[model samples]
Target: MSVLFFDIGATLADVSVAADGSLTFHPRPRVVEVLDSFAQVRKGIISNPGPGATARENAAAALEAAFGGRFSDEALVHWGAKDRRGIFDGAVTSAGPGAGDCVFVGEDPDERVFAREAGMRTAAHPVFTLAAVEGRPVFWARIEAPDDRSPAELEAVAKLDEVVPVHVASDRLVLAMATARGVRAVEQSGFTADLRGQVGETSAFLVRDDRPVAVPVAFAQASAAFRATAEATMRAAAAFAFVSAELSGSRPPVSSLGPGPGGVYIAAAAGVPVEDVHIPGARPGHIERLLPDPALLSRPGQARAERFVTAFAPGAPSQETVDAVRAAVTPPALRAHVARISGAGPLVDGDPLTVRSRDASSADNERVVDALAGRLHELGLEVRRHEFTWRGHRLSNVEAELAAEASDAVVLVTAHLDSTGAEGEFFDSAGRSRPYDPAVDPAPGADDDGSGTAAVMATAECLSSMVASGRTPARSVRFVLFNAEEQGLVGSKAYARAAAAAGDAIAGVLQMDMIAGFQGGTRTMEIHAGSVVPGPVAGASDALADLVAQAGPAVAPDFTVQQLTGAADPAVGRSDHASFHERGWAAVAVSENFFDDTGPATGTRQYHRPGDTLLDRDHDTDYAASIARTVAVAALTLAGL
Candidate 1:
């Protein structure tokens, strides 16, 4: 006799608020099927109703809409913050010791802490509740497999029954909740145990500073604020039904549940070790931005992905057109520009050179902004400072507009002006980089983003020169340098929101962040176009990636552009381009080989470190120029050569 309580939001289903205040709960992938499978066991809810006069009523209405007659026992329907032991204690008491077993299932690790204190087992995701009942300790792990092996082949070799692969993020990357022994079996199957950590992340569960991890998937987000509208919370009975729908489908008679955001939700699909699903007509090489919301069953939207695609539409531009623009973007000019802003050479303002810490708290960040703005002003483009406030400090994002009279459609060339050496690989006890402090640390992020900024500036200068020659493209261009990017992408998010609010008709955004870190002679670079939702216009981010890939062979014949697809693309939300993706705008990121080591070219080892200066040999100027030219040609083609 087992009983369970669950939290809503991301645990059961994703939420959307109608223009009106009414609540609607879209059941996650398999909530109903899983709940029915455990018909023998009692079920209840342990969720927050939010703060408002009618919060409880709103939540109830939505839950009833999604899962009618599922939780019949009104006494077991608990609603309150699960931040303390009191809530879970009440839940345990309500279940009455005779329930035999009790567990609380949710995505948050910190709330799981309170449940443990209340003597109830906790599962991070509903998929792991069965394991929790069976008394198995679940760990979060990242799995990387060889490209030659298919998911079925990897599953057979790993004997996943023993491993119990819970959920997956990408074909190449799987986010699984498995036991230590299961992890060993995975490692034995020749899969790389990229990173592993405990499910709960209180001090006791946190990955210690002494742990030897080369790259952290992420620091503990247990402290992150998980907010939800009052109307979207699905009761526990609803959460289980959807996962079970994915795990054991067609067996259950429940028919109404569709995919919210879980592994494969369709009955024909089982567990996902890889994410291979794509919108119909999307190229196999196309990268789908993995957002919290699933991109399945999508239709073309108002986003002008086709406009950008038609600009650099493959095989559309004549060789003469490509070469004319390509020759104007020289390698020597790109190198000199990277040096000026990256702190490898003289300061653009002639202010005494200091550390180039782009940390939001650093004073030097202002100086970097001045130098970048100054350069743009010198290039004869109309520049504006998009100022914003964060933690009492004033910061600004530089926007340089190159307008055209022919069309109001704008294409953006963007890079972050900030730099940080806060990555811990060099000084932290946790075997990670020490926490970044702006007061003393040097963050000469030349290759990290100086290369990217240089690419944008170089493109701006090239375009300005061409426009002066009466070669203005049909559309306008905006070269934007985002500020406070390292501070959770504050600048870009703000900029995108403003663009959305103003209904800016942006054609596409080409973001270059770390385009200079080519180590091997391979000259390989990556373009990320993954987005979970379609663009606001007719095309998607994939079209923007195609423009870059197509431009590579035409403008920068020396470099190879590899398009990263699915959630595995490391640049998904890690850069400024992600800002535009959230606005339903077509956006893509260009970068050095930062995804993995298996690629032909290598990335900089001094990522986010002071050693990321342009002086570093790995900070390849010629390669940066190649990428700059590719993006320049792509933007030029989009603007119409």
Candidate 2:
């Protein structure tokens, strides 16, 4: 089989840093489907190692977490820099494929060029390589513009069949016109004086098109003739009973066009007879007095938002489920959980519990992990710790599993437990910063990830209570608190990799990160799904988002849920869901606004900063509770409750 060498970063996955200075490499959307589609073909990774030994080790762990055993050891190239030709040569040799039999799929133009120079075909995207390997027809064409028309017009014609535009001189149009008219004697030399002025050093291009043709003479002529043809076509389609209006000379008020019945209002203002005022494209039976619906023309985002809210109205599900979810996910409960996690409660003496450093050896990080695991165990969950070494630091993930009555199918709910401050910079009350020794400083990190961690813990408590009350679900549920996520998703990647290796049937992963802060106004929450991830996985992601959307009205009727597809912010994929997405599992992230903004009420900004404290003014636990409730409803729905 022909071997395919793939690039990792950006092309396959996106790398993000957590609050604790950990990095998480999230796979691009639909990568799982893309990889599975080529399962019959051999695949390998050709990635540049990270800068330092620690970074390199983290990259290796991330790769294993994302791809698992899908790629063999010999097929993987994660050590050396990828810019060198030696790397390409080595990758080909390791894959046991001849130079000609191998194809390199990468996102970098320079790397692709280097691969091509090494005698292997290269594609900028995996889809293109798949197309070529499947023997699909790849169209290509070249055509010149005709006289009396611009290159852009001719280019439009070329674009019809996905062809590239080649702009030749205007005289080429005459040649094409003559050729179309079957004038065999016509040549560039025979062009008239008018056509000669248009001729110059024009560019020729090679384009992609479906049709088989040496030169697209007919296509060029059609493009050049389009304007006249279009006018004629429109005139022919028009009913002659309605005369074309001439309102320009009447000096109609331009301001009348702002809104309302602009044409009729203009005619009336200009004292032109309504019957004589002809609007272009108006048919015989068209209503002259009709006004455009402002809602139709204006942005319908609000209306669409209402539809989502209605879908999640309480009436859609049983009162029993809704009550259970509500009782478990209350504002007071969430607030207390946040207080404990942030060390603002009496239990920890009000000192900031800095979970910022992702280094496993950090006392604070391990202490937080122990505390969370103890809480899960107290809630009666079968707790397990997933341990792995990343960047020479040993990391641990705390997972609590609630097995269902008879199913092995699993629903994974997760959050990153690590927090981060201003790195080394210390900020004052006014947000002014100064360098400080991290060892002596504190990063409260109450909102960045503490909110997520608390929500997951709260969810576990709620579910455990339901289970104890004899309300078991049809599928098993796992509540996982990931470590080193603030660094590079080190902990979750390890868990996902092991799950895939064990052939675990994970139904989906709902990642809660930064869900507590309320941006005020309409209390909006953002649901993110990677659009590039396709097939059942992408569908599942969308479905999960939709569930969250529908849960808004039922759980938090006062709030609005906005679903964002592949959020432009890189932070959207910087969580544990990305690891599951990399493995082709369905995952979605539930969070507060994915943008940087001053707190709507308090104007205090605490995302990933030292001021991420558990303050009621900024970090609204009520808002977080609503989000938790919505998540609970969605989880129960997915668990087949």
TM-scores of all models? 0.53, 0.50
Candidate 2 lDDT tens digits, 1-641: 66788876545665543223345556554466567877777788777644678766766777778777666655455456655577788877776644237777764545665666666666544534564454332221113334554433443333222122111212232111111111212223232211111101011111111111133344455664574444433332232212223434544321121011111111122122232332343311111211111011111122322333344232354567788888888888777777776657632435454343323335567677777777788888877666543323445688888888787468888888876553335667799876543344566567767788888888888888888888888889989888766544556755665565345677668888888776466677777776332234455666668777877788889876667665332333356776666555667888876532223332225655566788746788888888888887887777766
Summed over model 2, clashes come to 23
Q: How well is each residue in 277-394 modelled by candidate 1, as lDDT tens digits?
A: 2223221111211211111111112335555555545455556556765666666777777667666676654666744566667887877777777788888787776655443355
Give model 2's TM-score versus the native structure: 0.50
The candidate scoring highest on lDDT is: 1
lDDT over C-alpha atoms for residue 150 of model 2: 49
Name the candidate that leads on TM-score: 1
What is the alpha-carbon RMSD of candidate 1 to the true structure?
16.6
| Residue 625 displacement in candidate 2 (angstroms) | 0.4
**What is the number of backbone collisions in each predicted candidate, taken in the order shown?**
29, 23
